[model samples]
Target: MVRPPHLFAALARGWLAVAVCVVSADLAFCQGADTDSSSGTVVKAENREVSARFTPMRGQWKPASFGGDGPVSIKKTESGDELIEMLAGDPITGILWEGDFPKENYEIRLEARRVEGFDFFAAVTFPVADEHCSFVLGGWGGGMVGISSIDGNDASSNETTQYKEFETNRWYKIRVRVDEMAVTCWLDDVEYAVVPRGEHELSIRIEMDPCLPLGIANFMTHSELRKIEMRKLNVESGSTDPAAVKVESKTEQAN
Candidate 1:
């Protein structure tokens, strides 16, 4: 006896259903692959790499005291680079700036969103005689910008310029520019701080004995990083637009 065509059709349908379920599970796994930084205006991380433009600085490692471990989550995309979370002792990773840079003015821009936790930190540095000059933006229940200098001897000189409040687990756009005699930072197009460079000349150089890596650190107990970007500015052309600056000073204290 031969089976009816309708019975064969029903069997085929059952097999098709199973195939569909398998494909769906595979796609979900791919989407969940370790990646963050989606928006182009932010830090481009798609596949497994991060996109950053600098004077093309290098990396130098420094011992950190935070009692935790974090991973540098990166992804590759069709157009640019992307990053998910950079954690050293916290959730996000630490950016280490250790390189030899020519004394010239430059601009830096990037986007960052807080996913979890209450605080995050990122900075740029110029090392001098075991001491380095830097600008740091930190957020803990809020956000702040400051200037600091660390000597190779482990001594630090620091000051806070802007302390503004920000929502936890949210994305904030940021821009920092360093010119010949001044430095400025912005949070979501808002002007936060402007400091005169004074007599300190920015220097970034690495020697065969020890290489320095230009760095940015995301310091948070538990947080997610959406994007990160870096660009060298043209000081002579004055690429900054004062008219577009926005200042929000609603400081949120750490809980």
Candidate 2:
């Protein structure tokens, strides 16, 4: 049962070498998890930096252009930013962005503030490929965020539904990006919802069709919108580019 001193030393060294190897392997595995395998780059989803370009759409919007039973007004603020307001009264009152809108792979951003009322302040209807969808902000008594009519269900009944407190008279920056894989939304630069694009059918409700192509509406609420901009996203680079084409604004009377 007695081993030579040299044999004992050899066994100890062997165990030490195995321990070193195990520790090295674990460190390597942990490092790999923080990297993007395909790109061989460090992955940083927490605060990913984005580079993007934006091009301004021409023609100042006129109140007469955006027709609805409720009052719609477009005024230039003291700071020279265009402000689009919809007064609360009718069930639905909105103003369509009268310009050519991209079908998909783009991000739309704007600043919205609830001036009055208790319902949704900004319901943005946009295009998702051939179909259409709406980003309902401050809905269901003013604290819901989600996409409408995913798989024939309204935003309140869909998987992307989320609730966040929204204060009236305070501006919030809202952004929505639609790509081939998913539709992601951010409020004040914080992510709010990520709806995967797959078997689900994306469509706007019948009442929202009037504001389609691209539009902002209020549901029995008074809302103000400004700094409305849209940029085409470059999928591979994860950046955005200014749209090249510019179209004249058109007026469509509300039905």
Candidate 3:
């Protein structure tokens, strides 16, 4: 009944992973948690609770009426996954998550795939306290990633601008974290952008006004979106807990 030291270490690692996934019935949610930022700052994504989920069961994701946008619909895939599909958008197409969401200390997670076009496929607009901004994915001729309008600069011209090659028809995991301090984005576990909130003015373009507090859009692109979930985070920093602040009271005052 003897075991090697390496075997014991392997078992310990396995148990640690299981402990992390115990937060949700869907193991993918925990396994796919986002962390870190482009600035090399560590971010803890565990111990959070799911706040909102945009799915067929929710019945609140509506096609954005951005004038000549595409046809959008919810359909069950061959794999039995429910997804939102946007097709044939002349210039822009989008869907709005028609529900209240946290303005700060929350995370947005989704899977997106470009079916056609060479523009951004999953541009997520979310609230940053009183204002709103967007995480543009596969934009600017299909390879730019950044937040829209930071201190009056578009994603293409902002400090958070980044580039990553994207393949059409391939699903990409995307996560965005909006905390009291900064807004960070991750693409497939790779840190994409991180912009401090206080140092910059966060906003969306006039074309993205309809998105408002929360929504996902495409720029002349046909795309499929699925498993869009919003999560409320608890941990903040080592010295101070983010939840210690009266978030509910703060929200009411802002409103």
Q: Model 1 over residues 22-43: C-alpha lDDT tens digits?
A: 0221222112212122211111
In order, candidate lDDTs are: 0.40, 0.67, 0.70
Instruction: Tell me how candidate 2 scores on lDDT.
Output: 0.67
> Can you give the TM-score per candidate against the true fold?
0.49, 0.71, 0.72
- In model 1, the Cα lDDT at residue 62 comes to 43
The residue ranges of model 2 lying beyond 4 angstroms of the native Cα positions read: 1-51, 57-68, 237-255
What tens-digit string does per-residue lDDT give for candidate 3 at 1-255?
A: 001111001124435333222121222223222333332223234333222333322467898878889999998778666689998587889988787678877778889999988999999998888999998998999998888987788989866777888998999998887777567777886556666557778889899887777889999999999877766754335412121212222234367
Instruction: Quote the positional error of residue 63 for candidate 3 in Å.
Output: 0.5
What candidate 1 gets wrong by more than 4 Å, as runs, is: 1-67, 88-92, 97-103, 124-131, 139-142, 149-160, 199-213, 223-234, 237-255
**Any idea what lDDT model 3 has?**
0.70
Which is better, 1 or 2, measured by TM-score? 2
Q: Which number leads on TM-score?
A: 3
